[model samples]
Target: MAKYKVTMLKMGTLNGEKSNMTMGRNFGITTEIPMFSVAVEGNGHKIILDTGIKSLEWARVNLGEMYVIEQEEDETMEGALAHIGWKPEDVDIVINTHLHYDHCGSNHLFKNAKFYVQRAEWEAAFNPVENQQCFYFEELFGWSAVRYTSWKFLDGEAEILPGIKLIPFGGHSVGSQGVFIDTEDGVVCFAADTIGVLENLYENCLPNIMTNVEDGFKTFEIVRNNADFVIPGHDPVMKKYQTTDFPKVDKIR
Candidate 1:
């Protein structure tokens, strides 16, 4: 069995509404959520989960002033990978938890990697639900130089490698998936937007951004049942586990 070392890469930050994350809660409040890309390295393979956001200027112009995004000098996707002794082309597989702009923005960087996305998600990226339409940007994943040629779509839950499982549990999007990587610490779930923050799993709340609220709640139970440790999609607290070590459950808070 290959014991992978999972590292959370902080690519940038977004200033968003609190209710946008907690769903129906924290309505008049705003919060800063860190954007991260998870790196799973070991067993002669390198994999990335969710590729982080695009340039700051692109976000401001395309997403408007409401979605203020910022990326520091060291927070670029290239910088994040370099911090772990990796470059984009060195990655073998890129799994997109969902097709949101913030999650797949750097998909183009991995020119030599195969990009995996759920079949439903690939379709939804082209024709998302009314509310989610604005969040999907085809250029980020489809119109890139690598384009659809290097893209692969999964029908549902599948394993990309021996110790890496792609669990498609949709709610956050039409085809949202989570990456479960077997680490020395146990199965660590990179619980995408379905589990936006640790509080959502601990408090049994749903994120405001979702295609189906009911499915979002069900995905929470999936995480509780399967994950020994969890890395949330947009939580600042995950920054503590940015190292190359396999993080244990107790270390997450």
Candidate 2:
């Protein structure tokens, strides 16, 4: 059995309404959420969980002024990889929690890697409802289909590798999945968009953005019960848990 080291790569930040992140609370309040791409490295494998958005302009134009993006010129996808001693081509696998633009925007960068996404997510990207269009960019998906070599569509919970599992739980988006990693400390769950902040999970709140509110609550409970600790999708609070050995990297266990 191999124990993988998980690191959070901060791609950038986005400012949005607090209510948008935590359902039905903090209506007028605004908050900045950190955008990240988690790297699970070990056993000679470099698997990335969601390839964080690359275009600030596109995000602004699509998401609107309510979502303010703050990304430095140097904060490119390749640059984030290099921070942890990796290159774009060094990635072996790419797992998208869902097909949201922010999560899958940089898929083109990892052209050599195999992408693992939920079957429901793949279908939703192609035939998105009106509300989903803001988050799911058709052009980005088209680019990925033409650029990436392979894609593995999962139906439910399955172990993609020895100690890593992909658990599907729809909430933030239909067919959204969470990554579970067995580590030295315990099992760590990347809650993905199901819980974007610690406040959401701890306070038992759902994000305003969800395809199914009932599933969102259920997904939150599932994540809380299953993992030792969770990595939220867009929380800057994760920075406090950074590993001393790796700069800009947070350890799950």
TM-score each candidate: 0.94, 0.90
lDDT of 2 by residue, 210-253 (tens): 89988987887777667777888888777622542221112231
Quality of model 2 by C-alpha lDDT: 0.79
| Top-lDDT candidate index | 1
Q: What local distance difference test score does each model get?
A: 0.82, 0.79
Backbone steric clashes in candidate 1, count: 0
lDDT of 1 at 118: 91
The lowest-lDDT stretch of 10 consecutive residues in candidate 2 is 244-253
